[model samples]
Target chain A: MEVVHTIADLQSRIKAYRRRNDQAVGFVPTMGFLHEGHASLMNKARSQCGLVVLSIFVNPLQFGPGEDFERYPRDAERDLAVAEAAGVDLVFMPSVSEMYPSPTRTTVSVSDVTTRLCGASRPGHFDGVATVVSKLFHIVQPDQAFFGLKDAQQVAVIEQMVQDLNMPIEIVPCPTLREADGLAMSSRNVYLSPEERQQALVLSQSLQIAKEYIQSKSSQGFTSTELASLVRAHIETAPLAVVDYAEVLSYPTLEPFDHSHSISSLIIALAVKFGKTRLIDNLILQVRK
Target chain B: MEVVHTIADLQSRIKAYRRRNDQAVGFVPTMGFLHEGHASLMNKARSQCGLVVLSIFVNPLQFGPGEDFERYPRDAERDLAVAEAAGVDLVFMPSVSEMYPSPTRTTVSVSDVTTRLCGASRPGHFDGVATVVSKLFHIVQPDQAFFGLKDAQQVAVIEQMVQDLNMPIEIVPCPTLREADGLAMSSRNVYLSPEERQQALVLSQSLQIAKEYIQSKSSQGFTSTELASLVRAHIETAPLAVVDYAEVLSYPTLEPFDHSHSISSLIIALAVKFGKTRLIDNLILQVRK
Candidate 1:
């Protein structure tokens, strides 16, 4: 696999791939930390297209002033090895200056969908996310782009943007990969202390419990309010976990649905803090018909 | 020239063009009235790109209440003839439903740039302009997109957005096309009554006087206050013309600039109403280095 250090080089390579006529480019954009989740996105891209391009750009604009931008994990050597193992055709790793030459000002924002969830916590967060993703989309101009369900709100924002802008690429959203303990894999997970990491397991553990509760129609079965309360209660029990948000949002819209729409393929998304580090995670809870 | 009615078709055509190794795609996005101004944009696109695609979408989002959305003049047959005459590769004419599907929710806005000129007269006007332009840019994904300098502030806003978002597309700003009488060409010109149409010349004439005043180094030459008064006085002299804005703005940034930036360009852009129809015009004076 080839490693590209500049936007121009990456764009030229993709431009050449397009010139080949027979090759289909599949893209996976990640903030490289070399987790299994990132690998799964690459695998999905690999399975779908003749060539896979993975961009590891830890975009600063997407993070809020208080967010973990300066300390965002970077493991380029390991990330490259993972990409090479996953059969990535090219790895695009652009610097901030390469991605953004000064006098840069444009932004792409999907309107209403961006007003809630993570957007609710960090203002201009989705705008930053949407704008950067749009830039990557144009740069890659892929046949298909892969995103994980872990960043459920992000997927929604991108999906809405592609649909609204009439951008011509298939947005393939894959299931979020998890660790053995069901913790949604995230780069920020490394920020957690060993004890805090153990406490963070309450996040995914509660979702599994909720899933079973709904499927079995147990006494603990939840309405939207009850589900939120149940999740909040479990996180509250974790001394190290200071929950930022614990809510069940409708699939795709990320809107706070009353109990009605929470049953079929709902997303249990949340953010929690272990000391100064904020970790986000989600579980795709399938409610049995 | 091919006519594409759907995004799917445009994408395939664009893909095929890519497969053939055509690197240049220049776009002229417009609302169909087929005036010389639009032709000028297409001409630029034709000169610049290997393939030129023109879209005539009378974007509803850009039109305000009491604005001429329903009454906006459209002549697709005439527009097609004009586009064909201008050497365009494709004319994309999508239905309103196609551009704005229900549940459509995305908006792109530029700060302060939208706070004046037409934006001042028509609330949410720039918001509309920004949103539609973003949509068009995404759909066309052209290497260079052409826009008129007649709407100088709009140009600045778009440039800001491109800079902020790191959009890879080049924005080509064309000089505003005007009638022999110096009135700026616009689709809304069709809405003017014969007398109102004749009176519309006062707008361009006022700006011409301002230019002459500045060039001749009249005592009021360098004073923004004096230039604004001269423009306003000329427009007000014609009783039928209601001045929407008559200000001298530093070109490109549209910020108030005097002798500050030695080589900065200045644009005195304004709009007026001859009867109820709004007309816009501008004079961009590139300051000597």
Candidate 2:
């Protein structure tokens, strides 16, 4: 329930906690306006770790000039209640000035993997995510860090960053938490009008359709084109759903699927537009090896 | 004196050592082939940290094609001796295969500042350096990291990385160590022929002359074209020295000299080619307030 502000205070507290016998720390980093998705992440962290530390930072570095940095939803009191309900221990909420003093110039990038999908749409977005996540990882020095698979490309980028940087914390990929209607939850869900919220359900349904297709077939792999067409048709058919991109990719790598790619490693990734908000969801179907 | 090759072993050992107490860890990351310059960095780390860990890695991602990645010098035994003499506790010398498993694909960058100086010539060089250094910072988990001002641009880039990422480690910049004749020390100093060695001295001597010119009230800061000419002439006159660039700059910012720049932050930076190895040197002089 303790909300720390400064880096020094946080580090000192984490260090002290480390000394009082082996305490396993778990971290969940988020931009504010928490939802069930963030709660699931905290739950995952709380399940395994002695202390769960969650960070609510709407990092400006990740947002392009035209992006939703200014308008990004933030409500710390409600977020605190959600964290408390989720059994979180500490909340490390830093101010923009505290996070980035003047002359802020550093960035953490995950190379080629970051150059695709969300990276293509929002350039340097993942760099900001990777850098902020890395900072949280260092500050909390967590035993395990939990990230939801809802942001599949972000999960990939973080995995690459931790591996490339040799960070000690274990990155646990939590299953994407969805609403009762099969809509994958996101903080930006707040941005959606009631009508837009109803349309967003198509994204998750399309992903489910892809998953069901692969699960039904005893084939080696479906062509990337066929899968794309099916998902695109689903999105285009809906009045509220507009297909931003619907592609089959190699799991983790984000490379376009080929005939050589096995069904077990195929990722049906999609970006669909519902009004002003762009929501991404992917289904990674694992078949017999 | 201990050389740990595997990432797991080093991580385990470091974790165990860290458990003993809150010992301040200091780090010096380098490509092996240790010279006095590197030894001085180790000595600095030794004095500042309870445990000094030096990692020697010639990161491939930082080098472009036609760059000397394959031919980059390395001498583990010599590096070990120097590290040992300098009182380093652990020397992490990981091979490419060990540090980067086959599918490595992440990078860290420092923007703006990286877009200038060394970044201009080497393109993605600082990106590579930032990525590797970030990896090192994570792996070593040092309280402070040491860097040489010999690579003034690298120091700036790293400072950017450390700040931008909000990494916990302090970046300590050591003065550029030099040979008796004024040649700045570098691992590539080995590549210099006996004649090339003499020519390399011009890089430093030219800066020394510039320093004296500014001290003697060589024209007003930005208006002193004569002082700039003298600085360039010193390098041009040397038979083995080919001037890469010689310019007066504003320190820290690395901006070209302009009328508005504060005199207190004026800096003179130079780069020269002595045979095949390019050498760099700089001198910072305070401008009148």
Q: What is the lDDT of residue B14 in candidate 2?
A: 85
On a 0 to 100 scale, what is the lDDT of residue B33 in model 2?
A: 88
lDDT (tens digit, per residue) of candidate 2 on B210-229: 77767666455435466668
What digit string (tens of lDDT, one per residue) describes model 1 on residues B121-222?
A: 888778778778877887878889998888788888888777666567899899988888888888889888888888888888988898888888845337
Candidate 2 off by > 4 Å = A219-221, B218-225
Alpha-carbon local distance difference test for all models: 0.82, 0.81
Interface RMSD, every prediction, one decimal place: 2.3, 1.7
How many residue pairs clash in each candidate at the backbone level? 10, 4
- Residue A188 lDDT in model 1? 86
Highest-TM-score candidate: 2
Clashing pairs in 2: A109-B107, A110-B106, A111-B107, B263-B287
